[model samples]
Target: MTDALQAMKALIEEINHHNYLYYTLDQPGIADADYDKLYDKLVAMERETGIVLPDSPTGRVGDQLLKGFDEHKHRARLWSLDKAQNHEDLTAWHTRAAKLVNDYNTRNPENPLPPLSFVVELKFDGLTLNLTYEHGRLVQAATRGNGVVGEGILAQVKTIKSVPLTIPYTDGVIEVQGEGIMNLSVLEAYNQTAAEPLKNARNAAAGALRNLNPKVTAERKLNAYFYNIGYTDGLTFADHREMVEFLRENRFRISPFVRYFDSIEEVAQELDAVVSMRNTFDFLIDGLVVKVSDMRTREALGYTDKFPRWAVAFKFEAEEAITTLQSVSWEVGRTGKITPVAKVEPVDIAGVTVQNCTLNNIGDIERKNLKHALGSQVYIRRSNDVIPEILGKVTEEQDGEEIVFPEQCPSCGSPLELKGAHLFCLNRLECRPQLIGRITHFASRDAMDIETFSIMTAEQLYQELGVRDPADLYGLTFDDLIKLERFGEKKANNLLAAFEKSKQCDLASFLFALGIPNTGKTTTKVLADHYRSLDKLMEATAEELVLLQDIGDIVADSIVSFFRDPVMQRSIERLLQAGVNPVSEEAPVIMNAENPFFGKTIVLTGTLSSMSRDEAAKKLEALGAKITGSVSKKTDIVVAGESAGSKLTKAQQLGIRIIDDEQELLQLLNG
Candidate 1:
């Protein structure tokens, strides 16, 4: 029994030490599997002996579910900071603070406060967390409820791996304030597999923390970074920097980006730099917090009823807005999938007028509790230059109508089939929108490269010429086109010439133009390269297709299903009969280890005057350079061209190599 107790103690200490190292220090000394083994052994010992230490790591598993949160009184109030949206507002804040400092100095010459230096930290977009510690152990955790009092959520807070259960400061009681955040990457991963995807990171973190079950909070994998010591007994710090060091020494996760500036001008420049690189951060930051560095200065310039005079939050431009969801309109794609687009009352978001918001699918609508959101106020967010998405309804009162799902296709009046969360129109051949979309996509620049073929042309061909399918396009003669209203002799000849040019397209382009269910250009390229012929690709089993690098079960199934369709087969046969021959254009690429770009991940941004981005990507791929769409730390090089945007900025911030000169890029490609 003695030996078991000793072993349990040793294991507990070792696991806690590793947890501190991994979470607080960001320096993991032990592998995850090894750490888990140690944790499991400790758990087994505790179960056998029926004895668990007060601070045992196993307590963080969150087995207990709470009925409700008990209110906790904070020793020191958590004051909100005044907000400054622009430089002018920030300048005004600085002027007021400077004036207050001057007045204080004039009143008390002998005990004048030191110079008002500033501490700038990123304003993390998350839920506010206040952790109370007494005698080196975490006693309570709470939200910033009415400043002085909050709902206790210690169990939920403990599930956060980075939050310390015990601190080194055992002298007396202390309250540390921080933000509980769900990392953007973690949120994205969770949403990909979640039954109902979370709208945003901030809400995800907040909802997890406020949940009745601690297990729910643990599942979120929350993280916290302490910034302020709101209450402390028998502890004194000269400045914010010293306080931050104290937090760091006590194994608290302090942000590495805390910067001290003497002048507001320097702080303004730093804010700009932060804004430019904000997208690169794993966590969301809505703005920055600027606070007086010196504790004495902070004390001298006290607080108002709601906010501190010494500190201010610099808010960025609004990316979200609340607007009435007027109605829902279902739109069909080339794949026959039905999408619900919410038409909202016109509202401006981030300087753009947004009326329509994406609801993703019917599952998203139900999951987000937005089924009855029509005519109700809904929260809409515009981010990353994509179409705005309706997050959820602002209130649950349901002062709106329930969105009725269409029984039949709006365009073709065919029975709509519900597949998973999406509604699909099985009537693929006759559906106007679906057929038009497929034909338009086939003639797109990345597909068949059919010049002079527009959506208007497709519509005219569909209605006037009775062109039902892509196969029918090949049968069109100059006479058929010249008879149409706006078609002249030169235009007719050009259309015929383009059709002739499109017939001899590469296998990859031809495959892409076919509009296979889930297969994209990249997948088609992979299929073409692997098979080297269309016949081999058609004969490939899903099992064999899944063996490829990027091909998964979903894509493999899609490929097999597309090729086996009788209609698709007939369409291909008709194209072949019309002299449409898709041949493999790729010569064998020999990978050279000596090549500079070999095994490197490269991103191409902006326009390359010498060639199209696609042409450049192919050339780079020939030399063993892997092309990617986005810039990240993993990107080895960025081929920046004229008028590069956010990707270029991100590459610069990450210190990735950039090739801006066209001549230099040409030299590398040619060589």
Candidate 2:
């Protein structure tokens, strides 16, 4: 009961947030089908307890005209099915069924349970309707409002051509439950000139169905699928399959993808197939519903106050949406790479409002065939934590203007070069974006460990002192900083102190901090492992660099090109003069055959209690251990501390030895 209350509160908040996204912001996160799943659950809860929250979306009617549509009492109550997000949840449900069946078998040994079979069908994402037929003609249609009394959208529902106005053999009172939907094409057409654009097809169908005018609904070209029998008399079906067969034989529109699975594994596998072909359908679908085949079993496994224990919906991740591609926001990276970020009109995909998603490069733009000229609508995907990716342009509805790529840098006005797949700016040292990126990289924990320095402070330094390079940061004075907006005497002291502290960083740290193109932390570690000293690496020829383990021709050229720059050379010299010393990793290591940590792949993750992660890695490297970035089968050990994530899980799965903290690591290092 407590769980139900919490679920009710959560559902209310979630539904209201989606409502704001759809109705107000014009950017809905989830599709109408997904929204229905959540709404159905809330309604089921309300029906069970008769407890309704004032702010719940279940209590609310259409966007407008609540009083316009006449209310009609439903013949029988409507209920919503609970959902399962993953295969594990589905398996758990099956496990519960096994327990129930086993208990039943114990009670009646002579009537042992038969092999469990189930039906899996595509779950439509649209508005639910309860249609009633008298004799051989459709009499009324209703929206599932509070499950008891519904808004009589009979005039509007009659506009749907897919619904059968007259079916043969329709005797006594018969109530059929189905979904009212609009196709992708029709929704697109309606949104093109609507006063306020429709977010998706489901929402469009819903609004049209509840419309006071029947003609408004007629123009939408709505469709529907009848799946469940709500209220029935003078009919006795053996099972769900028999009833669905009746609907299909009578020419009622039903989903095409329906199959019987003898096992949960087969059902789970079929779900994967459904997902793969989800986009093939003309209409949208959220998930597939799995139900017990035997009506007797369904009766035995009765209702759990809300949904039936006999069935559960297997939902997929959020569906995709198409929206206008307003324009692109081009920005420069630390490597002077010009990236194209799409500025899309707010659209919801999978419960996320996406406005900006990266297009990567010119090649990517051409390959995806994006018109990208400020008016074309694009196909975008929004998944959890994933940056929305523009699939491609869906329509060519755009203004007759083209977005020309600039040859000159937007920041420093230097000529841009087409470097392979990306655009690069020659003005590396002077460009504000690159300069800030470089300084931010330099002050990063894995680089120089300058904790007090930030991008804002870097900007302040640039504006005040014209400090344009990473080395220019070390030359800043306490007096120079004290004049800035937020820098007080204490902050000035802290900044200077942090700067002084970074000078004692390791050789690999300094190389990584230099912000040399393509020389990431891993590459620096490889260089540190091979060359043993920063000066030796700086003096090495490109030919010599290419001979090293992981160093490729491109990386070698980048290293040679960086050291050849007189400006970069001066910057390094000035940094050295300012007391920045790149130290070796303690002592040179020789292979000791019996050393406990010898020639083993180890990964370091999270914060170390004693020293920084870089320091610990270097120390372990000095003891003939190789510190790697990721955990794999080759990894002999994983040194994990607090807040360990996926790496820890991988290590545990592989049965690899784990060093809990620096203490255990040190113990193994000395042993």
Q: Tens digit of lDDT per residue, candidate 2, span 593-669?
A: 78877888888765677777767777778778888656656689888876565677778999999988667777766
Best by TM-score: 2
lDDT of each: 0.78, 0.74
What ranges in model 2 sit over 4 Å off?
A: 1-318, 396-400, 592-671
Question: What's the CA RMSD for each of the models?
Answer: 25.5, 22.2
Report the C-alpha lDDT of model 1 over 482-565, residue by residue, as the tens digit. Answer: 999889999898888988899998999899889775465666787888898988999899999999866767667778998999
Global fold similarity of model 2 (TM-score): 0.47
Candidate 2 — worst ten consecutive residues by lDDT sum?
58-67
Alpha-carbon lDDT of model 1: 0.78
